[model samples]
Target: MKKIIFSSYLKLKSAPLAFMFALLFVAASCDTQDDVQPDSRALVSDNITAALKNNNWSAPGNSSAKERKPTFNTLLVALAKTGLTSTVAKEELTLFAPSDEAFAALGLYPNNIGNVPNLEQILLYHAVQGELYASDLSAGFVPTLNGAAVEVTLNGGVQVNGADVILADKRALNGVIHVIDEVLMPPTLNLVELALSFNPEFTILVAAVQKANLVNTLANDGPFTVFAPTNDAFVALLNELGFPNLDAVPDETLRDILLYHVVPGRIYSSDLSTGDVTAANEDTFYVNTSNLTITDANGREANLVPSLLNVQATNGVVHVIDRVILPELGN
Candidate 1:
């Protein structure tokens, strides 16, 4: 638990070099766009000033910070509290700046920053070392300063850890900034606790797990891979089983079904191939890479939805499946 105590942000005085560079930047723009460095190094050296500007550093559009001062305030205050303001202001970094609405969506208020446990970890999770412009990113795991990795998917557009990159390639003098619409949460909870964090979607699944008394087993200490089913998926299961709800299923039967959805090790979406992986139920599950599908023991197949894939947890990984996996009773 890293406690972040707030302090006043010591302003760095502007240097002649910064003004000289800003003038040079305008002059360079008259030539060709390719001639200029495609990052924040082209802007004023005073990052604190650059971040507060209305227009983005390099991006040719309105800036997120300009639109939502409060969100920027939240982020900047966190950096100042952690004493990382100078590091971001002077060093090379790539920050995924979340929008004001993003923090609101996560139920994070301006006052919540100091009270949140591992507050520094959450802020550091958004930053990566070196200058990474939007064009420099590729679809894979990006290691962050928080010592955990965030997955970047480039199928439709840029997405980091399921958060859509609303605005990309905003340059800052000290680093680069990309505006994201969702907060990239760090893996602070175990599988069970993490699942509970997303209420309503996994409400039925949570209830079933609790009823089975498998909370400890799932949350104990695991590098487990889980194929979690959403609420709709559980409803489908109840209908198929002729039950009114999850509670109507026998405890042993419910436990077996839930166990069937879990794999005993960390398996990410990128690691999938056409092969057989054993589930926690000791039953074989088939993985098909060509179509990105997972097949259960009962011959039921669940396609891995891109939007719901590769959710990281402190103890392991979780992927949301469209359907609930049921094990063959005899097997």
Candidate 2:
């Protein structure tokens, strides 16, 4: 009887050991399965949010978008009007949102907002396609989805157009947002359109553009940096040539003159050098002169004093110069 009891005890102890071994095998299998699974990392959009939250966007006064009331309102309205509410809600977007005060200061949204044709364009000018934080913006031009490029001038802080990004990095669920004081406008003018805006002296230049049938081409996808001449500059050139206007000059002569001011690339004010640089027409031009002067085709030295420098458009940069350059005439 005692021997039977001992055998039963041994069997019970053996059963417990077997159950322990089975449990150990199951845990080992689970660990191996875990190893076979994919490793998960945060997405780029997620990274953007994490960075902003860490910077205390949710905190007070630390963020500009929070401090200012009108600017925030303008941004919200623009987002809705541009059909970007869903986009902003879904994906991360870094908005260089202008303040309502900025709009009021610029007289953009006067009493009548209904008559603005360029409202959509004005909104698009503020947005970039991807999520860019303050750290991501460098001293280069970034292309916007609006088919234009905004110059990212990261000096002390990021300046998009002439507006300083007062609030640097604010994060949203879809993208990042930077609060800018000024509303950025797209310079949709070609060489002629630009000339018409400021320089009445370029009336002859306008006629020449019409004559060459190159208005559409210049208006097209150019990042063409035009060293536009001012009215006084053209008047001075005309005075030197003893001509009242470009109508006195031949059509071909005027065409060559207009083409001389244009360079193929979008050269911003930051890119200019104080030496001889070549134009797209293969003629060498000098920026070494005091007022950024260039010699035209007529050998008539024209001062390239830009009435408006760094006029950024989607296709190119337009620098309104004071004098027309007649490169072909060699005058």
Candidate 3:
């Protein structure tokens, strides 16, 4: 429900630098709200029957292989529908396979969702370009075949974009399959667009961005991580700076401060650690994941809101913070 469009970091050991999108800081259910009520299980069963006809359908596993519950019935349908079943069976790629329940959360089943826009792209968002096992997964931004990146988190347990990996390192003919809990929908907007979409929540943040003339910069194909402050945070900043409103703040100063909130990569909450994270302003801020707080160069600390973390956008990632990070002014 917190719609500030922000990003953060938790752990980053080392991995391939693939980028995904920044999130629009809304709850997942809100993002998946559609007109149609969830389709019945009978429809899902029908899709599975149709998908079974695709001989290329080898994921979840061949019957001769390890005998499991075949939980990926819906995923199998998606892959078969896209002719991606053959690809998953033959290609050396990694798939974060979501279960039927994951798709059900979006009111999607194989047959019912055949008309969904960009179905192929949505399926591709769940895959990477190479065969990566759980061991190969380091916490960082990993580019998916969809041309966007997915966030990998190894902090407590392995999580992809925020979906828990209930099962990991399931081998495929050409790649690995990791069963995940949620279906990750690709981000549709960039940082600025995402913020503006939330209206009054980011009204002040969006204003500061426009006044600073950073709309285009933030909207560009950046894989940037923005530790966005809430509207309340901006108000608190105005009180701290003894200013009545954002208009009283100088442009250069606002720009500098805003820039300080942005880091140059797609850092997820899992990638954050206890260290100095340099911002886009060429200044650095300290993050302590232990306390979930960011300390700017001025030694002032801002807490990352626990619930509003790791929202993805088309060009970047976003983490909603409770305070507006400050950068030193007047040298």
Candidate 4:
């Protein structure tokens, strides 16, 4: 699996005022290993009743199963509420089960599960349609039966929405279970929800999207690859422009600025290069050191110091850039 590294972008000090056309250059850098791989182990195929009957699930330190403790009562209750107990008990599936302590930490209760807006959706998010072990998880958006997808970010630690997988590859009668540290929520409200859920630090990016009237566009479709700028990126731009804040800039300008950072297709970090790549607006810009540094037509340079790169969404990918990419005046 390709490990998605989340690092924040750095603040730049200059604004590009003139367009400078240059030939594209492909830098010969070290080939970044793409960690997108699926787990090789198949799902547990034994009969559910027999597996549960023979498995001594109560012993906390039992090496027969995984080291992690299973929330036997909580899991049963949640499955019953979602009407998935029978299916889960019969079929082969991989459940990324979060412990009861995780739910307690989130202040959620079993009785209140039905009251949550997307509780069923959230519960389904833990289950993979088919059987998969820890090796099956790759660095991409994996769809759930709930009509929503969750990102599998495998890096130094396996993470699902910044929550690490504490224990992996525990075999069950009907499926395999990977214990996660926190509850994973499904992405909603399109890209806005995705940004907020993936990293709360992108609040500024979300606000800018609302201000630009492009929230709906981003939410729509076409698998856009957004090079999102962090709050510090916007603040640094304002400082360079000698403005008190982003509000000082006209909405039209802000819209153009934000749009320039987005491309029409889903471009993963492994696919990026140092060259003049066309953006969604049909304007071309230069990327030096792969996406480490970006230069606009007007000789303005905005370094792509991302806090987190390769954030996958069902419809697109998000790379959090430190500074906003401004478009040409006439374009």
lDDT values for all models: 0.76, 0.65, 0.77, 0.67
Clashes of 4: 19
**TM value for model 4:** 0.55
Assess the local accuracy of residue 90 in candidate 3 as a C-alpha lDDT between 0 and 100.
58
Over 4 Å off in model 3, which ranges? 1-91, 98-114, 134-143, 147-170, 179-183
Error of 3 at 110 (Å): 6.3
Q: What would the TM-score be for candidate 2 when compared with the true structure?
A: 0.62
Please tell me which model should have the higher TM-score, number 1 or number 2: 2
Considering only N, C-alpha and C atoms within 3 Å, which residue pairs clash in candidate 1? none
* Ranked candidates, highest lDDT first: 3, 1, 4, 2
- Across 1-331, the per-residue lDDT of candidate 2 in tens digits comes to 4455446556666577777576557666766765554221222333332432333334224554654433345455555565665555665466777766777776656344434667777666777877787778788677665656788886777798768887765655557778777888876665556656655656655666787666886777466887766556667778878887767867676666677777887777666778767776677776754566665545556555455677765567777665666555545
Per lDDT, the best of the predicted structures is 3
Error of 3 at 83 (Å): 8.0
lDDT of 4 at 280: 75
For 1-331, candidate 3 gives per-residue lDDT tens digits of 3332222212322322432122332334444553223432222322222323332223343454533333667777778788887666656678888877788888988777677777888888998877787888898778887756788888788998899987676554455567788988888788999898868888999999999999999998578999999899999999998999999999999999999999987887777889999899999889999999999888999999888887778788889998998877754
